[model samples]
Target: MCKKKPYLLSSIREGARLGIQECRNQFKHERWNCSILPSIYTSSSSLSLSVLSSALASAHSIFGYELTSGTKETAFISAVTAAGLVHSVTRSCSAGNMTECSCDTSLQNGGSPSEGWHWGGCSDELQYGMWFSRKFLDAPYKNSSDSDVLSAMHLHNNEAGRLAVAKLMTVDCRCHGVSGSCAVKTCWKSMSSFEKIGSYLKDKYENSIQISDKLKGKVRRKEKNHRKIPIKKEDLVYTNRSPNYCVEDRKLGISGTHGRECNRTSDGPDGCNLLCCGRGYNTHVVRHVERCECKFVWCCYVRCRRCESMTDVHTCK
Candidate 1:
């Protein structure tokens, strides 16, 4: 695919970046925080070096050892990235950048006349995007042995991510006929924003289920009593429990919460008491300056006065 459609390389990179950034944003208040580690690779060809220097600089940054640890975080990463790829590829298709695909025309000239609306504009072509994402991301696990629990978990989460994109698709309509009267409407299907997809995946992560590491004919809950419960395609799954993430562990690449900023008030995950893991926190007064009290001038410019304020900031001890 890369050899045939080189233009998609940019979209693929964008998708990866989108996924990693969303992962970090969703976990910002958590102990893990989705921190990345630089990857090392060797290539003898100059072209590979050029590609590495420019487009693929941070390609492997998100593949921390934890990704293979079979934790919930890993599930979230897999799902988000898979969704991101579908999003970017669909966008590229809509923008007319790709030769193999374009906006979906299946619904054209199809709608109920009684409802006074028709499917006319370019509905996003999600099918092609979904197909491509699956082929590209799932190829590695296709031949994996049945005992590869981590591979199975990743494959399931990848589908969950793609499913999220499909589930959140919405219909947009434009009114026509004499200054936008309620006479006619053209509706088209559109994808939800990537932020929404990330939020959905985060919710799934919070409720992620732990599956038995030992693969029997199919995946089951780690707990024997709940093994009868059926796992849904949309649910995120993991095989291993995560580290406490309160103290630094170099071996696992967990930075822990030391010196991390925390909210002095509130009882959420960001609260000092919880984020600090009972080690306590330190308070500091920090000064902030920014533009304020702006006014438009007669010309094409505006003027503003600088404002300064001192606020208390807290960090985990």
Candidate 2:
């Protein structure tokens, strides 16, 4: 068994805190930068940071002189609104499912693009950091009916990784796992009638189960909306992370290495489709299918143990 390293856990916690901080800073700066683009776009930093800085620079020579702050702000607002309108089409490009575009024709035809859209397709890249898997169960909670998906992910995974997932996949957790129309009961083999009867008797479980009255309504200190640091009036100010992360010996760990259960990747154990070990333990990415299916491969699935909601990957052959 691998012993939990205190420093290692500390480092992980620090990294999460830092990433959250960085994300907030980036958004705030991006918004502030839009307000200053008229005077700043031609500068070297804007080259790849955003906007075809190159195109904007070339137009600068002909257009001559900088844009006023109001002009920059107006253009920035238009871009944001346009991008939001078109985000559904743009974001699905990488995943090979972009028909849900923001085009007027598509919208008028009673189609919604907000199902999945991101601007400039910038979310396609993977950053160097921790990743997680989230699951959504059919019921508002978990029970024996949900074990199969969890077990299947385990079968294709290492001992340590499986054990961690087993405990972590309870009520209050979310997941992106291998769930099909068939009950997630006893995969690879059917169960006896007695076992099935027992399954019906178990309690429904939820990802966000109430721990207790005191902690129930309490929010995670870190997940709360950040108190925006006020910018200094005299300096060219950049946002700084909150000082809470500076503690000397604070430590944290996920229920499993992947952290929150609801916060899972779209791909199940098969997301990577590789033999590489997941963080803290060994795991192999794979697609699990029963011989019973006709259209079995190349589908993304999400499972919720609570409602016992298992999506259909394909019809049984």
Expressed as tens digits, the lDDT of each residue in 1-317 for candidate 1 is 66766777887777776777788899899888887764333354222333322222223344566778899988988898899889989989988888889999989989976999999888998988898888878876776665498888988999999999999999999888897696989999999999999999999999999998888776778999987889999999999888889998878888889999999896999999999999999999999999999999999899999999999999998
Best candidate, TM-score = 1
Q: TM-score for all predictions?
A: 0.89, 0.15
| Candidate 2 accuracy as TM-score | 0.15
lDDT of 1: 0.83
Total backbone clashes of candidate 2, pairs 3 or more residues apart or in separate chains = 31
In terms of lDDT, model 2 sits at: 0.22
Misplaced by over 4 Å in model 2 are 1-90, 93-97, 100-243, 253-317
lDDT of 2 at 15: 26
Give me the candidate number with maximum lDDT.
1
Q: Can you give the lDDT of residue 100 in candidate 2?
A: 24
